[model samples]
Target: MSGLTVTLQFSGGAELLFDKVKKREVELPALEKFLPQINKTDWSLRELLVWIKDNLLRERPELFLQGDSVRPGILVLINDSDWELYGELDYKIHNGDTIMFISTLHGG
Candidate 1:
């Protein structure tokens, strides 16, 4: 990692927005170090989202999620574009690129 940034947002109103991130930038190595903190439970983003949907959003009874699903309810933007459109979770991110994990209902 050598100069990267990650923007995390959510659809559940303002409570989910990170007040501390503030369009900040960090080294790629620093960003990579945060990988463990971003819920990459099984070495992959999809796997992490599965855990998130089950564990975090378990109370949302009507919500159903899948590993490769990317749409209105879920949007993962990497480097300003949808990751799904560019090899999905396997998309390669370079230094200075920003990865934004957003749940729809925000600006999706």
Candidate 2:
């Protein structure tokens, strides 16, 4: 909480869990508490995945679009549906609104 100003939630590929935040300007130890071991707090959403070779099945982090390279596997829901369907990351957040990040299942 001391590191990040915004709130981050995890789900879909993971489970019902809340995140310890890390600020855009600052990196803190608390960041590792919520995310998977492969998830680098320093890397952006996209970069982290590629760094780990897209093995994001159970590995996910609460990511802001600015931080990393977001791709198809990562479904970022601002309120409900895709944030891109709404307005990409530019979509503003209101009080008490929840954002969800789900990994897209590829093979049917």
Candidate 3:
């Protein structure tokens, strides 16, 4: 199967959980990489969260993920638009899409 390329950005302290790397261009498999456990063919933010946790996340996963979704106070944007506006976790991922995660839990 082919791959879907997407841009991922982390900021507002979210990057700290990803080895402090703020930007990344990732190519995810077109088919569900986790089979049997996941029967879906398309990739969604919900699945991406698991993928990130298993692949991208370096440490302290609790800081980035709360259950199946991102921790509270973390803002997620897809293609520069709010993830909530795009069906949140159910949104289907497309090639060349940009996903950004920003933590709002930090103090000034």
Clashes of each: 6, 8, 0
Alpha-carbon local distance difference test for all models: 0.46, 0.42, 0.89
- Candidate 2 stretches with Cα past 4 Å from truth are 1-8, 14-69, 105-108
The digit string of per-residue lDDT tens for model 1 on 1-108 reads 334433334444322433423244432234335455663322334543443344344344233244354345656677678776877765555544565655545444
Q: Decide which is better by lDDT, 2 or 3.
A: 3
Query: Can you write out model 3's per-residue Cα lDDT over 4-105, one digit (the tens) per residue?
Result: 889999999999999999999998865645643777788889988988998899999989899899999999999999999999999999989999999999
Model 1 ranges with Cα > 4 A deviation: 1-22, 30-72, 105-108
Per TM-score, the best of the predicted structures is 3
Rank ordering of all candidates by TM-score, starting from the highest: 3, 1, 2
* Two-way TM-score contest, 1 vs 3, winner: 3
List the candidates ranked by lDDT, beginning with the highest. Answer: 3, 1, 2
Stretches > 4 Å off in candidate 3: none
**Please, what's the RMSD in Å of model 1?**
7.3
lDDT of 1: 0.46
Error of 3 at 19 (Å): 0.7
TM-score-superior candidate, 1 or 2? 1
